[model samples]
Target: MTFLPPDPPNQSPAQRKRKKKKRKFPSQSGFWTMMKRKKAVEEPARVCGPSNKVELDPDLRFGLEKAKRQLESLRQDLTQFRDRLISARGSLDRITTEESETLEGVEVVIMRKEQDILGLEFDIHWATDYAAGSRAN
Candidate 1:
């Protein structure tokens, strides 16, 4: 092949060489920008998340109310049980005799009350969720 000069008198040798070696691939930034624009346009319209508002059936509403009341009662019972446990602990510390050994039964009672409170709390949460109608109807 023979080398060719620029057509215009003012055109430089580099310009002539560049014209011969025209780019086949777009620049990195331009390619990324185009892809981003295409992605934005081609994407589905913004998706809406789950709606929290739900209608509660009458039975479920009653159950939820019952659960709420039960939960409150359990919480109060828990506070009383905790206070008793604290007092028992203090009494045990003061009297390290066989009296402390007898207090073991009181510890068991405190633990059972705690378990009951936890169970009630769980029930309340479940009842509230059920009442909220989480399932598709």
Candidate 2:
């Protein structure tokens, strides 16, 4: 059994005739595609102004002042950023130092060092110079 549908009873005589193949028109987008590709390969020409000295008007002076203020603001922002970075680095250093020197062990080491320094006999030459200086006073 065929799966094709039956033709409509109201079909026109024009519908019976075979339709001619359409002549495909080239796309407008594709026509400029090569030119668009060449644009990517080519370097854009740089525009240069005349080298003659131009007098600065009030408007130009205002623009220059505005630009200077913006530059100063940016410099301040960079300085603040650097200050924050330095502070962050310092905190990180402190954290690492604190981690390395645990409370119980580090305190014991510090105490031992203090005791050794305190128990040391003063150098004879240095002590004599100090005593002689005190007498001169």
Candidate 3:
């Protein structure tokens, strides 16, 4: 089974075939839009100049100046921190290098002491054998 809605008997075939009226959006046609366009045309062209000064609200200007000062202070602090870090790193490297060189010198001294002890032991052993042979004779 199929369901179908009956069309209106009063509406003619020509009326049904007629195109829908186009909608008028806010920008397309309006009293305010016309007035705004007219005002824009009447207004003088602003001079294009390279100006550093900006017209900001008093509160905004104060906040901007404060922010700039804070930024500069932060930059100075960052520079100091960087310098200190570099100095510390350099000191640490120098200390490490000095310690390694001192350790190397100590190792050389220890090796020389071991050699001297070995030479002394050899001389003592030779003297003991000489005394024993002389006593046996």
Candidate 4:
């Protein structure tokens, strides 16, 4: 057997020119073109049904209104309690002021009663409770 390779076939000039033209003008089969055509033909529809609408029951509405009224009343009560507490605290502070009276070369320290101070502290505690209850409601 001969070890030489066979001679290749010679293509005509017309066939070579056609092949060159095909190479120059490549096929228009890109993925984006196909995707654009598909999107142009078929688009997804976005729609909501009647079930999405909100429906509030009459009892719930009434309850909400009642709760709102209660909240308003609680706020007013809390405000009144706070004002009373502040006034009481101010009066107690005034009573606690040191008053020095020199009677016959003897210094006298006149301390006020502790009952008003205790009463003011109690009012402050009650005001805090009123505020907490209002927030909880």
Candidate 5:
């Protein structure tokens, strides 16, 4: 069991009751009091951003919003243009590859045709010489 100290004999019943009713944590009471005083003295808070709505003029606010929208539109346009450019470049590369392959095939065919023409010319020259030799004999 806990031992209790005897109340001072000099103190009246009312004083003892008042002392008992005092805050149990005097330090905590001081902190709360300071917080209350600080809040009372402070002004209403405002946003610390680039634009404060309360201070901005109506015309200026409209202009700023319009500029933001324009910037967004331009950004989207740029993205679309860039995508189109990429697609065009891919199409060009594909077309170039196809043309190069077609060119190679055409060159092979031309070379074979040229060889056949040369062979026909050689045969014609040999036949003419043989006919001339036979007529002379």
Candidate 6:
């Protein structure tokens, strides 16, 4: 089934389109104004004279002195540490030398025991041979 509806009112065409103009920035105008103001002001001419001197604060100067003293103390401590380390290394080297000698002594004792055991075995063998010869005779 089809349903019929009443016709809607016709609308008029839109007006001619106008090209959008680019926006003028306020920063350029401000810059030009600042430039004109700077031109109007006269800059002071430089005179040849002694440069401005800055005085150090007394507290800052005292703090710097204290820091220098602390730095010197730290350096001395580092030097002492290095010296002690060298002394300790020397002692360690001596200990190692003594330990090596002690090890050599232990090795010599082990070798001597081995030789004694071999000698006893040889003596026992000779005694057995002598007894066997005496019995055969």
Best by lDDT: 1
The superposed Cα distance between candidate 4 and the true structure at residue 121, in angstroms, equals 36
Candidate 1 to truth, TM: 0.31
Q: Give lDDT per model, in order.
A: 0.57, 0.46, 0.51, 0.44, 0.53, 0.49
**Root-mean-square deviation of each candidate, in angstroms?**
15.2, 31.2, 40.2, 26.4, 41.3, 42.0
| lDDT by residue (tens digit), candidate 2, 1-137 | 87756656976545644343444765867868966854432212121234322233344346545655655565566556545645776853454455435433544554554444343222222333443443345
TM-score for each of the candidates: 0.31, 0.27, 0.33, 0.28, 0.30, 0.30
Once superposed on the true structure, which residue ranges of model 5 sit more than 4 Å away at CA?
Answer: 1-95
Summarize candidate 4's per-residue lDDT along 93-122 as a digit string, tens digits: 443233212221121111122333345445
Which 10 residues in a row give candidate 5 its minimum summed lDDT?
A: 40-49
- Residue 52 of model 5: what lDDT? 31
Report clash pairs, candidate 1: none
Model 2 residue 66 CA deviation (Å) reads 0.3
| Candidate 2 lDDT score relative to the true structure | 0.46
Candidate 3: stretches off by over 4 Å: 1-19, 26-55, 91-137
Model 3 agreement with the true structure over 1-137: per-residue lDDT tens digits: 88755656987656765744555664665778887865543232222234322233344346545655655565566556545645776754555566557545655655565565556445434444443443345
Query: Once model 5 is optimally superposed onto the true structure by TM-score, how far is the C-alpha of residue 43 displaced, in angstroms?
Result: 99
Among residues 3 or more apart in sequence or in different chains, the pairs in candidate 6 whose N, CA or C atoms overlap within 3 Å are: none
Number of the top TM-score candidate: 3
Q: 1-137, model 5: which lDDT tens digit per residue? A: 99867868998777988877966686997899987854432222222334432233344446545655655565566556545645776753555566556545655555565565556445444444444443345
**Is 2 or 5 the stronger prediction by lDDT?**
5
Candidate 1, residues 1-137: lDDT per residue as tens digits?
Answer: 99865478877877877878966675978989987965543232222246544443455457656756665676677567656756877753565556545455555665676676567556545544543443323
What pairs collide in candidate 4? none
Poorest 10 consecutive residues by lDDT, candidate 6: 40-49
| Cα distance off (Å), candidate 6, residue 103 | 1.1
